[model samples]
Target: MMAILIAMVFKLPVDSGERNGFALTVLLAYAVYLSIISENIPSTSVSVCYLSLYLAFVLFLAAMSVVLTIFVLRAHYGTGEIPKLLKILFNCTSRSKVDVEILEKTDVGEYEHEENKLTWQIVAVGMDTVFFYVYVVLISVVTSVLTVAYIIHYRSI
Candidate 1:
């Protein structure tokens, strides 16, 4: 769980200049975690209800991270290098849907003249960063509180 959280932190552009690699590592870690849990469950007769809940939350986090990573990579590096299956799954396109003639006629020079103008790509990256932080914080807080509560409850009995 901590590894996943760390990997997520590392995925952010602020932490690591690259995100796709860290995201892939996190996904692999998640797969290993799931495999270990599955292997342990059959040998133990103990109740796994709480474990299942944790698993669900982790799985959700993993899925969200995967999606975020895909979007970030596509937005930054583009879809040209992405696999055909993944490109299809993500519905990625190499170029914008807007007509080339329209772009050619537009006053792109005027926009470039502005000193601090925000572009769509910058906005998208900003939004992605905000969402990533919020998701990580929310999951971490909830997991920590639940873990503490569970420990206290078990100790009382």
Candidate 2:
């Protein structure tokens, strides 16, 4: 259901920069996944604090799995190069316009509508880029917090 919703909500992105952004997010998710699983976690029974830390890490991974899955799906849709999102931001704005004569029609309004769509797509890509950075920062912060928590809990044990 979520996948279908995602597909329906996000129009098929054409910009190489946009697809690059999606692929980069997918790569970042995989990197975080590696970081989480690479830790030398102990299985020895300890205090409740340690147990809770372990639980938190597990839960984080669970949540990350969902995010990673979504990113991977989107990356597959965006078959372009590597990381690059700011390209759209430095290039587009509210006043931006597009003129593709190939997409024009006998009716001038039709061409205007297509031009408007192209302009909006630039904005959309910019928005997605912002979301990409936010997610990366968020995951990094959570990972740091949980790692620190684990170390403190282990030392106390």
Candidate 3:
């Protein structure tokens, strides 16, 4: 299976960051699930009203988790505050040598496609942007689907 192949190829180990990331991802995922449930349920029904409350609860939980994550990351890095760290994150490439080193390790590859060794850089940069755009579009489509599905469900009931 592809999963087994990936595991063998990467051999990545789970760490604290991975655990926190997974938890945050799951919280956001639950927010999406609750939003869908609340959006679809009939407004007149008690259960539907409760669904709205559930959606709000999940959204709050996700927000709190994100805030906690920001605090933890800032504290761990001794970055002073959230806003400053965010600025650093945005300016990570030019401002932080550690960030540059990490990027260099990941972005620079051994495989050479063209005669020059710069092929990996081109592929890495292009693939990163491509994936970002693809995911953004995918998220937009999902939001659109949710909106349409909610409207249709509301009209049908």
Predicted model with the maximum TM-score = 1
Q: Candidate 2: deviation at residue 149, Å?
A: 0.8
> How well is each residue in 1-157 modelled by candidate 3, as lDDT tens digits?
1112211211112223553564466566666777687677876874445336534644554455455444434444442233544444434433333335345665345322322322222322332333334434544554466567678889999
Could you tell me the TM-score of candidate 1?
Answer: 0.58
Q: List candidate 1 stretches off by more than 4 Å.
A: 1-18, 42-47, 77-116
| Candidate 2 error regions (>4 Å) | 1-118
The better-scoring model by TM-score among 2 and 3 is: 3
| Clash pairs for candidate 1 | none
**lDDT per residue as tens, model 2, 1-157:** 1112222223334443354354444445545644565464544636344434544544454354445534534544554443445344435542232233324423776665664343333444444444445455555665567778889877999
**Which one is best on lDDT?**
1
TM-score per prediction, in order, is 0.58, 0.34, 0.35
Per-structure clash totals for the candidates: 0, 0, 0
Q: Per-residue CA lDDT of candidate 1, range 1-157, in tens? A: 5534633643366335556566666667777777787776765666555665676667667667767766655565543344556444333432233123234655877644742433434334444655566776777776887789799879999
Model 2, C-alpha of 130: deviation from truth (Å)? 0.6
lDDT at 102, model 1: 30
Clashing pairs in 3: none
Task: Put the candidates in lDDT order, highest first.
Answer: 1, 2, 3
